[model samples]
Target: MSRLTQAVVLLLFGGAILRASLTDLYLRYVKEGLRPFLIAAGVLLIAAALATLWYSLREGETPDDHHEHDAPASGAPGDDDGHGQGHHEPRVGWLLILPVLGLLLVAPPALGSFAAGQAGSVSAAPASDSDYPPLPPGDPAPVGLLDYASRALFDDGKSLTGRNLRLTGFITPASDGSPMLARIVLTCCAADGRPIKVGMTGKVPLEVPADAWVEVTGVYSPHRAKDPVNDVDVAYVEVTSWQEVPEPKQPYS
Candidate 1:
């Protein structure tokens, strides 16, 4: 392919990434914190393409054929000398368009229940020196699903008991055995996301299918005594109430 064609490919690829980052579609693939880096990478690629086109036109960018030794004279369409520096660009390069088009046209959804099911064993509370803090003053103290799980599973449910906290997440059927609250936790991006879950209790009924977003309110229900060997992260919440809600802007925690 001509230098112009190569430059065009770079331009289009960069522009696609830039558009994805600007519109927050990038969240579907990567963490929100990567926005700045994504934008910078896209801009750099566009600049490189523009520079290539500018210099190629100025007749100063591409080096003159300062062949140390004469290249074997150009051969027939299908021929090649020992150093087959074929003039045609490799066809494999075209495969790159798959991701660009997928991002541009389809805008795939974030990793959800399907991914959660494939995740490995449950995650324990990350090590910490201090005790879990008390819920800040509020009627239904808003909290994350992972946060509640950690406190319940590892801390013997001390911090969570009697505190009417609120947790929002997508449904993961049978948190312990029945439909319960859950959220996907990402160590970096969707590729590494793991599901954190909490069983639900109390008077309200839960009828949502897996992946349905909801906000649940209640205190933690007493479960089997915490065992050091077996994780109780699948602790239950006495759901005084809950309601379906729109999914969050960033689905994974």
Candidate 2:
């Protein structure tokens, strides 16, 4: 890896970051809050590449004026050419191409069921005195999975009772074939994503394949179970109807 290769690698990596940020493709793997940082970092990397290119070119053009006196006292081990201008040869820098190719080509996907299984599942612990805000005005109120989980487990379903709520998320089936509608919440980025899941009871929703996004209309079941793993309550929803829906522009909550 020469300085030229280093610059090219930087250019590729930075281009991938800038492209992901500008095209809205980044939302799939990172939080929108990172937009500014991504842009700044990308621009800096691209600048480094351009600067390296300019230096390389300038170094190439002045060979006639070059002299052994220009060479540093101790040249690099292989550079017997005492004129002092040879690549530093950053062999390890080649490793940067792996992430560059990953981001540019596969563009890697958000973590899904497999990751959820490995991660410690989130469950809100039962709280007898938890206070919850009133559900916003709607017949079948639109609610988020995180909010619903908190209410169901801590507030004893006070906010959820008798209200048919609409919750949208992708499906992840349990090993026993029971389907769980799950939403991954990202605090900073997809690397830190965690799954909030609820078991759904409905013939139609169960039929939807894993990773298919859908909107579920349902009422929360009063009966909640204490999950031993996280010592948090796991809520259940009885779906009245469901339909496949386009994935939201920003999938993370």
Candidate 3:
């Protein structure tokens, strides 16, 4: 650990992975095709922490080339016998600088609505071919809370019946607090995120905020419900316009 604290913990973990992959904060924890492999692993860990701090400052300016290639070890420069050249490292490697100072000071937002209220169901993916393909002419059209919850739960809403669509997510209240419409789907990162939700039902928008970020406008409402933490089926929409936006810059999906 002490190669100058492993080159200052690999240059603060490669400058917090090159300041979160040089910016949209690495889409809040990966995906966006993993930003060029996280900028080539933060430029090869800051070029191996600057070639391990230039070979630990050229072995501290060659102290007589470590007494002409090691041998005279007797314990003096901070010693505990492990041939100390001022040793003592394992203080748990300074807890790896607390996740590189929480990824260089506080980078932690995405995965909202408390991870979709601690998820149990709603990660959508079923509808393979119960016959889809229709709503794209755009009156509202945008769609995609996992393709409107797999076409409202396996095509029962048949390509979202009278369309209107438009969805953008984040707001996961339900369980009587209503207002669902989530989104989080990342298959690889954000530790395998999940969320997808949907449920808004006609004119719903109880003043947003469960991770805000909205943009509703809706119509596909076969009104299904179950999912009391995994009974599954949950899709409805009927919203007819909502607003509050901003969070996107790849907040997953």
Candidate 4:
């Protein structure tokens, strides 16, 4: 690619990064902690692109003066059979436009039910101990899927015995066509995401579509079953109420 093309590409890429980082869109691909780094990188790229463009334009305006004062030596590395030939960039450099377009024009959505279905195992951290702290104070305390699973499996449902909990996640259908609430856990980015699932029973809407985000108020149920795909323990919840909700700003936890 020519220097002009390189500068343009850098500008577009940096703009796309800024656009995503300045809003919640970046959360779809990366964790929130990386926002500062992304913004800094975008700023640096834009500066570099502007500098390169300025230099290219200045050099273009004074090419004749430089050529008259400092001509290349004969048989130099860049000479082609006694004719001066500039370096040419490979065509592969153009492929970068694909990601630029993808980010700028149509940023991809967060991982959802499809990704949850394809994964064999749910990601859960080992319980630190058999005893867990009591649930926080709330009539319908908000809880994460992983936390509920840990308590259900390791603490024997003691902490969750009578507490009503509220969970927010997208619906992923289980093997028997029952809806299961799920949220993706990301260690770094979407590429490393894994789903944490909770089987939903009692009052689950039969017509809920897969991947629809919902908030369900339920109590932990001792009923547990091994995952069909990975044999890991899957927790259950007896949902008393549920309502479809918009997807959260941060889709992954």
TM-scores of all models?
Answer: 0.82, 0.80, 0.37, 0.86
Question: Per-residue CA lDDT of candidate 3, range 17-109, in tens?
Answer: 888888888788878997888889888988998897899787783423433334334544534455534443347867988998988889688
Each model's number of backbone clashes? 1, 0, 0, 0
Cα lDDT of model 1 by residue, 154-214, tens digit: 7877887777888898775552435656677877777777777666778544567878888
Per-residue lDDT over 1-253 for candidate 4, one digit per residue giving the tens place of the 0 to 100 score: 6677778899999999999999988999999999999999999999999998798787773423434344456566654534446433347978999999999889688899999888754746556765687788898999888999888877878889888999999998887878888999988899999889999778896788999999999998888877777778898999999999999999998
Which run of 10 residues does model 2 get worst, by summed lDDT?
Answer: 61-70
CA displacement after TM-score superposition, residue 194 of candidate 2 (Å): 1.4
lDDT of 4 at 210: 95
Q: What is the lDDT of candidate 3?
A: 0.78
- Point out the worst 10-residue segment of candidate 1 by lDDT: 61-70
Better of 1 and 3 by lDDT: 3
Task: Name the lDDT value of residue 129 in candidate 2.
Answer: 57
Model 3 misplaced stretches (Cα beyond 4 Å): 15-25, 30-48, 60-90, 97-112, 115-137, 143-163, 175-179, 183-199, 202-249
lDDT at 30, model 3 = 75
On a 0 to 100 scale, what is the lDDT of residue 129 in model 3?
A: 69
Q: What is candidate 2's lDDT per residue for 147-190, written digit by digit as tens?
A: 78878766768778989899998888764667777888887988
- Please tell me which model should have the higher lDDT, number 2 or number 4: 4
Candidate 1 vs candidate 4, lDDT winner = 4
Global CA lDDT computed for model 2: 0.75
By the TM-score metric, which is better: model 2 or model 3? 2
lDDT-based ranking, best first? Answer: 4, 3, 2, 1
